[model samples]
Target: MDALLSLSNDLAAAVERVRGAVVAVNARPRLPSTGVHWRPGIIVTADHTVRSDEDITIIAPDGRTVAASLVARDPGTDLAVLRVHDTDLPLADLGDPGSLKVGHIVLAVGHGPRVSWGVVSALGGRWRTWRGGEIDQLMRLDLTLYPGFSGGPLVDVKGRVVGINTSGLSRQLELAIPVSTVTRVADELIDKGHVSRGFLGVGLQPARLPEAFRRRLTGASEIGLLVVNVQPDGPAAKAGVLLGDVLVALDGAPVGATEDVQAVVGARRAGSTVTATILRAGAPAEVSMTVGERPSRRR
Candidate 1:
């Protein structure tokens, strides 16, 4: 009983520390949501929770309501950055999400300063969404994210923000976009009003290489991305890439998953050429293609 009581006090204190930087975002005609005061005059929330750029109100920690303007938004990561007139807003101490490990205790604080505690259930490496958004890291928690909790902060016991929690992107799991990803995306959104990504115009799925082929490429991965479709006149098609070809590597880096391809393509500028190593008919071949800017609609 003593141990349980001590744990409760620790959690309560952590929540109280984080509550100083938490804000309730009331985008009219939409449900009230939560946001983190990431910096002076800047609030970060879930992009899905923010319906529009106009007529938004921010309920500060002290319960003083003030108007806020939408600075920028990225639907791919489900993050939005809003600007308020108040520079005195308390800022959250951002933690390194990369340091988070499975079983670590985390707290999600939402509107009304509601707190939910849980453990980090899983952590995934870099991956791309079906929409082609490049995520630096994937973190999921075993916590119940209630309504209006979409844009809240997921913090550690030290009261440092681990990430932004959102339920809009995943149906079966509670996902927190890591602080590293959020910082990168938020910076780009603030500077450019949009995020740019590279494209190859090819649909790919995971495929396994035959035993003999895997042995031939001793240092290479056993799995690769199988091209299922190629857009006509697109970069891949223009470079003679075809359907059914298995992409094994990009510019010397192993291409084992869709995320690997995305990471390579996203790192390159449009109009730049990249060497694609593929297995066509059980034989390895190399093809060079110019990277293209990913269409905004696709993003």
Candidate 2:
């Protein structure tokens, strides 16, 4: 009985370490407390958790409840920000989600029926929401969660938060959008009230050059981005980037994948002009285009 008691005490201590960082978000009609908290001062949570409600009330571990306001959120990434009264609070240590690997021992911290424990079951699983939007860089966990745990923390054994408990996939598959993504966008949301992303207005797909085409061309692999569609009045259209065009490079750098183009374009600001090199038919060419701002998701 003493040995079992010791083990229980040790597990309780681990939960207590991260409990201060876990908060309950009570937005009246939404739910009594939809587990949310300030990472010191920066409030983070799942987008869908607070989308339907207003006037959020944040409850601390010691039973202190304070009013919090929604700052900004992106449904695409399942991330949101909240601002509460200025107070010194304990913050969780943020980790690099890009560094997480499968089979790593991770903890899911939430206000479950009671608190619970779990591990990362998988990684790099892609998911789409009800709105037909795709979520990137999702970490899967083997934990059970509900409305109260939507915005809780997923900490490492060291108690450092590695991801935000965003959503659950199945009975055994839980998902957390990386904490890095939330932190990055949170800065933009707080300072600018919105995330300013550049848009190219072109749908691209990965295509590998056929061996025959690769042999005729002196380039590696023949892999390139095939323009599937160009928005009617978008930056790509205004710049004369048409359908069937093969994107090869951006700003003099080789574009090896669709993500490369997304990175280059997503990094630019609206009204910023960039040079895109394309392989048209059998000829190499470039087009100068000005990027445009993506539409704000806030109503």
Candidate 3:
């Protein structure tokens, strides 16, 4: 019974420590969400939460509402950084998500001083979105993310922020953008007002190689990305990459899916040469292509 009381008290105190760093974000025409005071005059939140150019209101812990300006936003990672003037909000102590393990206790804190307790359900390594955006880490939580919690912080037992909660990317699972990813994106947004990535103009899908071909490769990967389409006059076509070629590796690293290709290609800059290994007509071939800059989209 005493142990149960101690646990309750610890959780309560943890929530209090995180509460001061959270603020309610209200972007007109959308439901209210949460934001974290990352530093003096700087706030971070999910990009999808702020869709319009209209003004944004931030409700502080003491119920003081103030205006905040949208500094920069990156839809690829679903992260945004905002700036508020004349404010000295408490900043959250960021923690490393790479050290998080399954079953570690955590708290999801949002506006209304709302708090929910849960454990880490799963941890995933680096991956890329279909749009070719790279995610540093993927985290799944056993807790339910209620309304107004989309851009809130997920805190560890010591009240350090582990990640930013968002359900925009995943449909059935509660996901958090890890602190490492958030900090990197936030820094780029602050410095350059945008993030840049390399692009390879090709549509691809995962394909399994025949057993005989796999044996010929002899320990090389059995799965690869099959090129379905190549953009006209784009990097792939310019480099002689053809339809029906199965991409097996980039820069000597094996690629089993589109995400792997994205991770490799995105890491390079425009005009940089990268070697691509592909299976063409039952034999492996290497093609070198210059990476291209990803064109800005109409958002």
Clashing pairs in 2: 23-36, 25-34, 209-222
**Worst ten-residue run, lDDT, model 1?**
126-135
Off by over 4 Å in 1: 28-30, 201-249, 252-263, 267-273, 278-285, 295-299
lDDT tens digits, residue span 89-169, model 1: 778999988789999999999978998889999999976655556678889899989889999999998889999999977
* TM-scores for every predicted model: 0.78, 0.70, 0.82
Give residue 87's error in model 2 in angstroms.
3.3
Colliding pairs, model 3: none
Give lDDT tens digits, candidate 3, residues 1-299. Answer: 99999888888888888898899998756578999998788989988889765688899989999999999888888888989998877898888786789999899998878988899999988876544556888799999898889899999887889999988778888989899888888998898787778888999988998888777664557788899999988899999999999988888888887777777788677899999988998898999998997776746
Candidate 3 lowest-lDDT run of ten: 126-135
What TM-score would candidate 1 get against the native?
Answer: 0.78
Q: For residue 53, what is the lDDT in candidate 1?
A: 73
lDDT, candidate 3, at 196? 72
Query: Alpha carbon lDDT of residue 42, candidate 3?
Result: 90
Query: Please, what are the lDDT tens digits per residue for candidate 2 over residues 103-164?
Result: 77676766532466667778875444443234566677877665577778877755667877
Residue 173 lDDT (model 2): 59
In terms of TM-score, which candidate is stronger, 1 or 3? 3
Instruction: After superposing candidate 3 on the true structure, give the runs of residues whose Cα lies further than 4 Å from its correct spot.
Output: 28-30, 130-132, 202-248, 253-260, 267-273, 278-285
lDDT of 1: 0.87
Cα distance off (Å), candidate 2, residue 146: 3.4
